[model samples]
Target: MSGIRDAAAILAERLHAFRSLGDNCEFGFVQRYGGVEPSGLLRFSYTPLEDLIRGLRCGFSDFGVPGDLRLSVSAGGTYYCHSVAYNIWANTGHSAGSIAPEALLEREYGRLAHLKGKFLEDLADGTKILVRKTGRDDPESDFARLAEAVWAHGPSTLLRVTEAGPGWVPEPARRVADRLIAGTVRRFAPAEQAWEVDLEPWMHLVDGAYALARGAAPARLDADAFPEVLPLPGRLRRHVGRHREPALSAYTRAVDPAAVRGDAVHVFSSWVWIPEDFAGTRIFAAAGYARLGWRDADLSRRGCWQRVWAAGRLRPEAAREPVGLGMIGTRRDAFWSVGARFAEGPIPGEGPAPALRMPPARFPGRDLLGRLVPRFA
Candidate 1:
């Protein structure tokens, strides 16, 4: 709220599609109206926290999906938003799962770390790459080399199978990696083989650890895997949705909303249904932005909030009675101020501003993967 103009300017650039008000408009811009016929809305302020509360309360009770919304203001007029919601699209895989040895190897996304060249640079920071070589996976490949290394090392020397790229790694470098792997417990993406190595007492990789070797394996480890998820981009530890993770996968924690001097904003495109069980429970989640609905009123609660529009030829002013329907206009000069002061003159009919539309995700940064740039609307 302190640097109102600056904030609007920054947000406006991110939201280039929105029709801008006059250069001197005090408040924010207009909102999206999902309807035919000449219908529109002009938003005085972006109520992020209020919207989140409404999203969760209504979402849990009706939709069974509890969303997170935070809107609070400070004396300095600083406002921020933290929105969380189940990624409807991403929840299916983990809803029910089975983890076998083949599953573990399939998700050995840790192998992505061993990559180099332009391929590595092109990938997102956290993308998991598979170990199986698509280029040329031969019998005398990295896997065979690893088996020999393990047998040669015996019990004294440690055996780790990290390889930079395809093919067999040099023995000297391989030995060095083994030394580092000996004492550490971190799950290194060992060079993979074409076939599975089934031992009589199958050694399970549970939660990135060799379960059978480390004392007695936890009873839960026998299952091989469980519902797991990773925090989305920009979110500290909020899961987009429950997803199947390897038995040796890392755990994802919840990120609490921290006080901020600046504002992180987003908008919900529909009246989200939330259950009652989610009361006072906060979580983080993020994913993709997809349109659920169109109407702004449907997105908010029932009668608690109302969409207000200006009633004038030009951009309408506050304090002035909601007289005419607000659609399009020239600049601020065509409207009146709350203090009963006329801006300039009966400004000429300029035109309608560009229409503002819904973003892809309902709750970004908090409930799903954070969006860096504004796309459609």
Candidate 2:
């Protein structure tokens, strides 16, 4: 169990690190035959999971494994809840005949107990956290039997109900199940928080990160993009205007527009750190951008901000030029401005997870990155 604690801590640390980078990082893992492979800092703008799936299939094919492989994968980043580490065991080999879906559902029934005994029961007191369990269970499966079981444990955030198998019911029936579970769970769990979902893994709920992964750089706004402009504080004005630099300039540096590729750009107010090397004509856009107070919120909230800002699209040619971009910071108090480079185009919805393009060379692919990275989607 201490190993579980250590692994959970590692997962927590990885999640915390990924979140701390603002919105400029990606993380993912691929599991084959119970062995987890760390998909190295995925470079997709939004489809790490999709790419990971392709990579997994490709890797399996390369290994010449037979039969239908069981796949249990989770992929998403930044814009997601911080999930503790969990494993999805999958096998590759000859089929062992069909198994009853109900019997398969039974396998999930003990998951919560397994989690509680090994980890939750010993967690430090007053550690605010949330736990969710998802599988293919329906009303006929008697999922309500475990209501008391879940209620016995803690995590007071919300309740999620997922019915994925053949016995899935309509919205009304699902709601009834949700109501029954919410009504029975004797805790601060709210009725509104009881959510019913599709057959996909619960980790799929964090698709926002994957969806926004690819897209046109928001900083590339057209001339007519600015329809609204608000007043700015004097301190903020000098910062974006480059009239003064932040005291902690030592820790931050200016970004080069020419160097921007598929990376995401974030704006910050000059009061905290001066944005250098911006196009001269767009200096006013900096002050205008400062209306968003994301930097301030980041200071207080620590890890809450994760959504991509829908600023404006730049022309393909504009990718080489710097542009002043602004967004309503996560805090919503004031906007922030920065001269950034957004080379990636916008992706609608899940779009396509980028293709897995391992260089054409013979090497130990699995050994290099084969460590299970906790999916905190």
Candidate 3:
């Protein structure tokens, strides 16, 4: 048998032994087959005996294969577990009807076993150290390398041996697995900075490493020795301000008229003033050209007028120049019929005499008109 096939056979044997002990295990395989022309791929995601319908549809979406793919999933114990298998064929012209999922699994299982064995052997020789040397300048990259080493060589090794069988596997496998797991947990866990970046992968490796280590040397495993690394406190603090509401009372109290006159308060708007009550106050009304933080405009040039409800009149105030209160909703609909009043007479060098082109009739309303007309009552 080829090296890949031989390794797969070993893995299968180990898996069989694992199942014999009542430990639940699921197996999956993905295969691709085709020719020079446009080909088709079929996938079967099955577990032990049950085939999952939903999983098959999802497999189709995930692979993006033209031909139909099949998937199945099952549980070995009370809790349902997942095992997936996939196959792809290009121009073979053979329908997937003939291939059995189990046969494909058996074939691929051998290849996986061989690959894993080779990986373990390279791991044993400290290949990780060589990889780390290639990018020593980047701290994040260096830490990832260290973390991968711990996972591949340390605890994961022990867990594999223990799961396989205590006495069934060679003494060397058990010893190696144990030493790697224990050493990694003891050394790496306490290093706070190392635990910070890409923690998911590190944790995965750590768990597998720990399991393998304990399996190899059950007596040597110190349950309490594992160090606990907590997340950084500063990271949480940064996000608190984003979700908090601003203090309205404090903001309203801070608005100063003198500051506005001095060009300090460039932006204007009721929203920027904080307290909604100050929306139409004299300070806001007189400073028509004042900048309101929310809206975009030069407040110094264009003044604002209001439609007074008490007098039922549209009162137009030209603060410095005869400013046109542009049509309310649309520029074409001009509401210029209301008489326009200026705060001061025309200054020298002023361009044109300010004009108020009012609408045909006075604004509609008794109470609103009352505010504009001088009160006789």
- lDDT for each candidate structure: 0.21, 0.23, 0.22
- Give the best candidate by lDDT: 2
RMSD of each: 29.9, 23.5, 29.4
For model 1, how does the per-residue alpha-carbon lDDT over 1-377 read when each residue is reduced to its tens digit? 23222222222232222211111111111111111111111112222223323332333222121223333333333332222441111011111124443343333222211221222222222111111111122334433443333233232222232223323321221123332221121122221210111110111111122222233322221111211111223111111222232121112222222311112221111111221221212111111122111121122222121221111121122222111111121121111101011111111111222232222233322225643222223
Worst 10 residues of 2 by lDDT: 26-35
| Highest TM-score model number | 2
lDDT by residue (224-321, candidate 3, tens digit) is 12111111111100001111223111101222222222211111111111111112111111113321111111223222322210000012232231
Output the TM-score of candidate 2. Answer: 0.20
lDDT of 3 at 302: 22
Return the lDDT, model 3, position 197.
22
On lDDT, the stronger of 2 and 3 is 2
